[model samples]
Each structure stands twice: as C-alpha cells, then as structure tokens.
Target chain A: MSDVSSLEAEVAKLIVRTLTLKVDPAQIQPEEPLFGDGLGLDSIDALELSLAISQFYGHQIRSDDPDTVATFASLRSLCQSIEKHRTK
Target chain B: MTVGWLRQRERGSRIASRFMIWMALFVGRPATRALLYPICVYYLIFSKQACRAIRPYLIRALGGPISRRDLYRQYHCFASTLLDRVYLLAGQGNRFDIDIRGLDVLKDRVARGQGCILLGSHLGSFEIVRAIGLTQQDIEIKVLMYEQHTPMIRDLFRDLNPAVADAVIRTGSPNSMLRVKECLDRGGVVGILADRLLKQDQATACTFFGKLARFPAGTMWLASILKVPVILFFGLYRGGNRYEVHFELFAEEVTIDRRHRDREVQRWTQRYADRLEHHCRLAADNWFNFYDFWEEQR
Candidate 1:
C-alpha cells in the first residue's frame, strides 16, 4: 500500500470514532475531502478532532486557518500534518 | 394568597425542585432521555398555577410564539442541550482543528504578561476554546462564568474538558476577579463572555441588531483597569464541527486616562460588537442563544 493509503485507514478510524460515523474504515479514500461532500463532519466535529489530536498524540490541529481545509482535505494529508506536529 | 402562606410554599417547593434537578444530573437513569421533560411535566402537572404565572415571562424571554406544545419543546430542547453538554464534558477528546488567525496579536499582548482579557461570545460551541492552552496558544486562560442554576449540572461541567475546565474562573466571586488580576499581573489571559446581560446592576445599554439592548460593560472596565490588550474572538460555528474562529485586536492599544475611559471602552467594545454580529449572522442556527437575546428591544 502507498504511504498515503495507509495513512487514510488510520484517519478513517478516527473519523468513525470521533464523529460516530458509520462507514467502513477501509472505504474512506485517501484523497476524499473530509469536510465537504464526503464524511459529513462539521464545526463541532472539528473541535472534537482538535481535542482528540491534542489529547491522544499531543498535536494541535487548528481549524481557523485555511490549512485546516487543506489538511483535512484528505485523510492522508491530515495524517501528514499530525505526523509533523506529533509531540510524542 | 396570604403573604405568609405564599412564602412558606415557595421555600418548600424550591427545596423539592432542587432535589430532583440534582438527581437528574448526578444520577443518570433509564429515563434520562426524558430528563427535561419529566421536570417540565412535573411542573405542568403539579405546579399548574406557577406555569400559568410564569408563562408570559417564558414567552417573552424566549422570544417565541406561545403554545403549550411549543413551550414544552423549547424547555425540552434546553434540557437536552444541558444534558448533551454534561455528557461531552465527561469525555473530552484529542485531535481537534483549533485553527487560529491573528494569533500573533493575542500572543504579543500575552507576552507582555499584563494579564490580557480574551473577550468571547456564544456564537459557536465555544466549549471548543478549551482546546486553546492545550494547543498552539500557550496562554493560561481564566474564564469568568455564571454558575449554571443546577448544582448537578455545574459539577458535570467542572469535569468536561480539563484543559478548559481547569481554566474557568467562576463569576461574581472575588476569587474570580483576583484570578483575573493575577493572570494579568503574570501576563496571562482571562476569558470572559461579555455578550450576555447580568442578572443585576451589571449591564449598560448598547446597540445590537440595530437597536438598544443590554450588554455588560465589564469587558470595558476590565480592559481599562488591567488595561491589557483586549482580544475579541468569535468561533462562528458554520455546521457540524466546522467553525471559523475569527480573532481581532479590539484595540491596538489602550490608555489609562480616567477622562477618556468610558468612551474609549465604548469605542473598542463597539468594534468587538460589530465583529461579533458579523459572524453571528453567518450561521444563525449555530448562534445558539435559545434564551432571551436583545431583551430590551424584544
């Protein structure tokens, strides 16, 4: 599997857990947009994601920046940002 | 309706009502989904007289057309919101999008360590702001809050998300004020939700929604005295978990002159108000003030 594909599998799990999404984890494509026309998450989910990232891996994900849309643009990209900011 | 009879009845009923509210919060049960309903039904069933007495106040405060069904729904929604808040508070997760803009503005002021005031409003699930200190912003936040009426719910909130919970400074207490001053003196930030009116001699008339409405002047007073840079923020909730946390420097800088103090605050407060309203209009449903808003105009 490509590095990006593997990254998305993990993020899909997070999406399932955090937002209570019902999709199969493997079905979440790496490049699929998480916010729009996809998993159907919103601002509260963003806050929950912020809390999740901060607590689990000690990384801070900010939603106020445009990067948020980009990072969360695809599961793979979000993982990359998480990998970059992972405190532990 | 003897005065003595009414007073005794009031005291007796308050004690009983408080007990049930406490039970719902602390002890979750099978009928938990009906928590708010049971209480409202209790009131309607037992306290028919009180329901009739307070119906007008409820209609006016809620700014809604009155019907028993609608009122019940409103009351029930309020209860559901309270319950959901409690449940979320119990389990705060990690991995959030705490996007920031103009953070440098807040950072520079906090760097001065003069204990800045982080004025916020209830446009978004600002409970999300608890993620601040735990994330990019290193400032310790002390929030001033009016304790929720129910003690059981209050305790639940106290444990929701420790990052934010630990930072809260309850309002109307000297400790809360001292903590604000202490954070300021240490060059930290104090978060205060200033949009809502106070229960007492606390608010001043300010223009909102194109008319005069009550708003607290405390943000101005705090800014003038502590006189730190007041940063205004609004986490405009667009939908789901999507929020735009727009930040601004309410004032580039402030002066300590007593003469210009009130107008200075009004000027800056107006700016903050303007920004807040702009975002609020962006997502009316997410604005989330189910209770009375613009009480004076309405």
Candidate 2:
C-alpha cells in the first residue's frame, strides 16, 4: 500500500513537472481526473506526458493499447499502469 | 475562433460523388475535365456562403477587387483538382504531368532514415503527393487527418486504393498521436495539414497576409516533442493537367522553450503562414479554405 502511494506521488510530481502546471504535486487528488475539466490537460499535454513517462519509466503508454484510457484516467490508474508495465 | 468551416455542412452528396467518380474513370481525364466548366459555374452561381467566405482571401491574394471571372477561375481550379483526384488515386497519375521541385530534399531525408513531418496546406491537391509516393516504394507516407469530416469523399477515395486508406492516421482519436509517433520512429513520413484549426485546438495568432489570424500551434508542438524534421509542401495545380509540387525544408528541428512556449509557437506558426502566403501569391486560385479564414474580421 505504501509502495503504491509512493508511486502515485511520484507520477503526480512527474505530471506537474512535465506539464509545468501551477499546482503543487501534493495537492493533486489521486482520484481526480488528469484530463478535460479536472486537470485541464489537453491532447498536446497527453503527447508530452506520454513522452515523459516513456523516458522516466521506460514504458510507452500507447493510445492503441486498450489499457490507455484506464491508464490515463487518474494518477492512481497511471501509477498502477507504471507498476505493471515499467521496464526500468 | 469561429470554426466556420466545421460549422458549414459538407457540400456534395455521396451518390453525386460516386457518380462523378464513375464518370471521371469511365470518360477519362480530358473529356471529364470539360464537365468541370458547368459544375464550376453552378457553384459560382449557387454557393453563396463559399463566395462570401473566399472574397476577402481573393482580394488579399489578387490585391484588387474580386470579379466574377476571378471567382469562376477559383471555382474551376478547385473543381479541376477534385476531378483529378479520381485519376491520381486510381493509379492513373501518368495522365497528368507533375513538375516536382525539391525532390532531393525528401530523398535526402529518406536516405538518412530520419522520419520527417510533411506539413501541407489545403491550397492544392494533397492526394497528388500520395501519387508521387506510389512511384517511390521507399517512401512510406501516412496522413494524419480528421477523416470524420469528409466521409463521402474519404470513403470514395479510400475504396480507390485500400493501401492508401490504411496509411491514414485519423486525428481526434486517442491513439492518433501514438500511431504517428510509431510511424515516425519507423522512419515513415507523416503528412499533416497545418492550415485549419479545430475548435479545441491551441492556436497562435500569426500575421497572415498583413492580418493577425490564428493558426493551430499543435503541429509545431508535435514536431518539437517528437524532434522531427518538418518539410513544407505545396502541390499547386497549373491548368491543363500540370502540377507544381514544391517542397521546402521548413525546420531541421522545432524546439519550444517551456518559459516562452506561446511566443515560440507564434514564431513558428508565423513562419508557416509566411510560407503559405508566398505560395498563395504564386497560385491565387489555389487557396482552398473556402471559409472565413480571418475570424478576427468576422
């Protein structure tokens, strides 16, 4: 549980850093949406975020992959995906 | 920004398009081209919205008042390109004389095995490039476009060559960028039309033809993120089955600094608008975005 939370926190920081969002990583809710109305991240952000994830975790979050939508749903889901697929 | 083009309904019916294709293929190029005169006149008389939308552009490009003859020529130019799509897509490109300028630029990229972005506009026949690619088996062209917008024309052309259909990476899909990235990684050329902007797109106001008009910054962002070479392509149609396909190396690499992202995007888009303007002057009738392009004026 602690490991998962830490991974989530790490992903939150990554997102904030990659997007240069004004909000603090600690303030981001695990269950809050990362796109659309929630985090307000657009498609360009998604591309940039995917690149960052691939570089940092060594796993490409492909759009064709069925798990992509679920993976990008929120910080928790994204962390879970990283935990499952991260090669590094 | 007013997405007038998106709001404007697609003009022709599927049956009409299919019939036109059948006529084009059966009757052949020259005979079928004669039919465009009546069709062009029909549109010039009827398509009031298109006329109103294009007047400003024609005035800007021609540097004078828009006359009926000028409008007819514009309509005829567009209709000619549309009819030629049948020949171009059906593997009958030999019928037309294509004057390809800057083939060396594309050949050099292919030689390097470095995937690049071919940034094009709606100025002329984009399909003509695909026809050129058919001769060169080495060049793999994948187009990123909004396929949903023009389903009738898209489906008709797609059926002409299933292989070309397969090369399309439809925009607005979640995996569209992923597919583009994969294609680029494989040293494949991805063609993108950077002229028009969707409602949700991030746009930068650029000085186009001395007016501050918004152009989508997303393509530049994608190029920067993927770190690929961008080549500006304009396939201008010269009357009587001749096409001047020009390719200019726009940027070796597009880099956006995080601190000045907006300014950088505007700079790149302005450069693109400048190139597009230059080409527009070269072929005034070739300007195909038959919509109120300068939303600011509206």
Candidate 3:
C-alpha cells in the first residue's frame, strides 16, 4: 500500500475504535463516504470521532472550518487533512 | 416519534410581537400582563392545534380529566411567561420577586472554575435563570438554542437583548458542539433546553409522567463526551411576578461506556425524564411542549 493509503487505514481504525462500530476497520472502503451512506455515521459520531482525532493527533478539527466537510468526506480525505494539520 | 413541532407554524405576527413588546416596556408589566387574559382566551378559542397538543400532557400531568378552566390557566401561564421575557431581557429583572433555590449547587461549580451544563426543559421561563446572572455578575451563562423553530419571537427577544443573542451558540451549525466545548473550557455555564426532540436527533424512550416518552439523547451524548457536570435547572413562574428558580446537581461527570452505549445513555436520559416529570407535577401549567408528545411515528 502507498503511504497515503497506509495513513488512511490508520485513521479508519481510529474511527472504528473511537465509535466502537461493529464493522471491521479493514472493511471501510478508502474512497467511500464517512458519513450518511457509507459508514452510516451521524453528527454525534462525527463529534466523537473529532474528539478522538484531537486527542490522538494533537490536531483540533473544528466543524466551523471551511474544509471540515471535505476533510471528513472519506477516509482518504480525512488522512490528508490530518497530515496537513496534525501537530504531533 | 414524529417531530411535528418543527412543521408547526410559529404563531403571532411581527406586528403583534412588536406591539406586545412596546406595551410590555412602555405600558409597564402590570398593565400589559392584564392583556394576557384576552390573549389567552383568543388562543383558546382559535388555536385548536395548540389546544389539542397540550391536552394529553395536561391530563397526564394534572393526574385527572382537565377542564376548560384548566386549559385557560395553562394558556395564561404561558402568555405571562412570554410577556415577562420582555422585562427579563430588558434587564428589569428587579421588577419580579425571584425565589432562587439550590444556588450553591451552581456556585460550587462556578467557584471551582469548572464549566458545567445546565439542562433545562420547556416547563418554565429559562429567561429567569439568565436574569440571575444579571444580578450576580459572577456566573456567566450561555444558551445553546435551536434557532430555526421560532424565528419571529426569537428575533423580537434578540432585539430586546442582543447580549443574550450574542451569548447563544446556535445548534444545527457545524461548529455548535465545538463552541460549546470552548465555552466549557473557559469555565462558563452552558444552558440547554432538552425537552423538544428535533427530527435528526436520536431519541431514547424514558418513562415520563407514567408513560414512555422519547427524549433527545444529544444533550447526554455531549455531556458524556465533554466529561462535565450536568445540573438540572427549572425556572417556574408562580403567577403575578413570582418566579422560582431551582438548580440540582445531576452528575459530576457523565460517562458513557462504549460497550454499553445505548444502555448508559438510556439510563441517563431516564434520570433526566424522571426529574423533568417531578418538576412538571410541581407546575403542570408551566409545561409548554405544545405537540402530541407520546405519539410514535410510523
């Protein structure tokens, strides 16, 4: 797997573990949507995931941020934003 | 359960709201409040939907069959609170005799410089709680409100007190929770009215007034995630400028175990419903959720 895909895999695991989703992290398609249709995650899940991301990566993902929607679009996009913004 | 309240049209026009506000401020509270009798009668005679919506809750909370007099009393109570908002928001809180109970519960949190959640319901005037802040100056209270439902009344009150509007963290916005977290981090108090269930909210069934009613779990979720103290507040209007504000410490920190998410949230939500029911019994007319609460959506 490429570096980007590896990072995506890592973030996908975080999402599953943080939310305690019954599905396996490996089952999450990298390009699939993280909310609504794909993962069936709602706003509360998004909030819990954001809190987890902030604690794990030392990055605060604010919903008010213009890129937040795009950043949370998919596992691949989430990883990209984390790469750009992660402090630690 | 269906969220019929969302589709329920906001009553009263801008002109009517403006007239009420003008009378409330200039005509004085006593004189303006007398007008509520006619207003209540008008709503009682015309607004069948509202009357229908509140009937079940009244019957349940009152613990018997209700009369037209009882319904009129409820309407008058609601109108009184609404008119009092004009005075409260305008910083004329001294006009009323407010009896505050369990203030030390809030003071403890404020003194510790730890932010806490004040979970209130539609039972009474939440504005009275903010009025406490007006006098004390120590406790900083911010309201987390769903602004979409009542734009006209909200705008009228917002105009009366822009500071109250400025302090509101509007829900449904992307960054709503983030702002709530930031406010709590600063040792500020955040108040939320948790009675009404929005369409997008995930609800947990709780026995309220001897029947299972669905309450939005969003507040509990936020509290658990934030790991903050949750305090229940009720500011009941006890007729003729007498308001009673009560505060009770609900939880030092709300925790939701991931393995038992639904169970834990349900337990907490039930606890809230129990407390809400207790307060509802205390002031049946103060209950303001004008919708078919127990009806499940198919």
Best by TM-score: 2
- Per residue, candidate 2 scores C-alpha lDDT tens digits across B1-298 of 4597887777878888888888888876777888888888998899999898899999999998989999999999999998888887888887778899997787788678888899999999888996665346667789998878788777888899888898899876556788888888888899999999888788889988899887888988888888999999999999998999999999999988979989888899899999999999999999889898997446
lDDT of 1 by residue, B173-213 (tens): 32245456656667677777877664532455666656565
Q: Please list the residue runs of candidate 3 whose C-alpha ends up more than 4 Å from where it truly belongs after superposition.
A: A1-4, A24-33, A36-38, A63-70, A73-77, B134-138, B296-298
Candidate 2 vs candidate 3, TM-score winner: 2
Provide per-model DockQ scores. Answer: 0.01, 0.50, 0.40
> Tens-digit lDDT track for model 3 on B4-63?
787678888899889989998988887888889898999999999888888889989898
Q: Give the deviation of candidate 3 from the true structure as CA RMSD.
A: 2.4
What lDDT is reached at residue B76 by model 3?
93
Candidate 3 shows a clash count of: 0
User: By summed lDDT, which 10 consecutive residues of candidate 3 chain A come out lowest?
Assistant: A1-10
Q: Taking candidate 1, what TM-score does its chain B reach relative to the real chain B?
A: 0.65
Residue-level lDDT for B153 in candidate 3:
85
Worst ten in a row by lDDT for model 3 chain B: B130-139
- Model 1 per-residue lDDT tens digits across residues A1-88: 4444555576678778865667888777776767647765543355456567667778866533456556766677778888888996
What is candidate 3's lDDT per residue for A1-88, written digit by digit as tens? Answer: 3344777778888998888888988888888888767888766677778888899998898755888878878888888889998998
- What is candidate 1's CA lDDT for residue B111? 65
Q: Candidate 2 lDDT, tens digit per residue, A41-68?
A: 7666877888999999999888678988
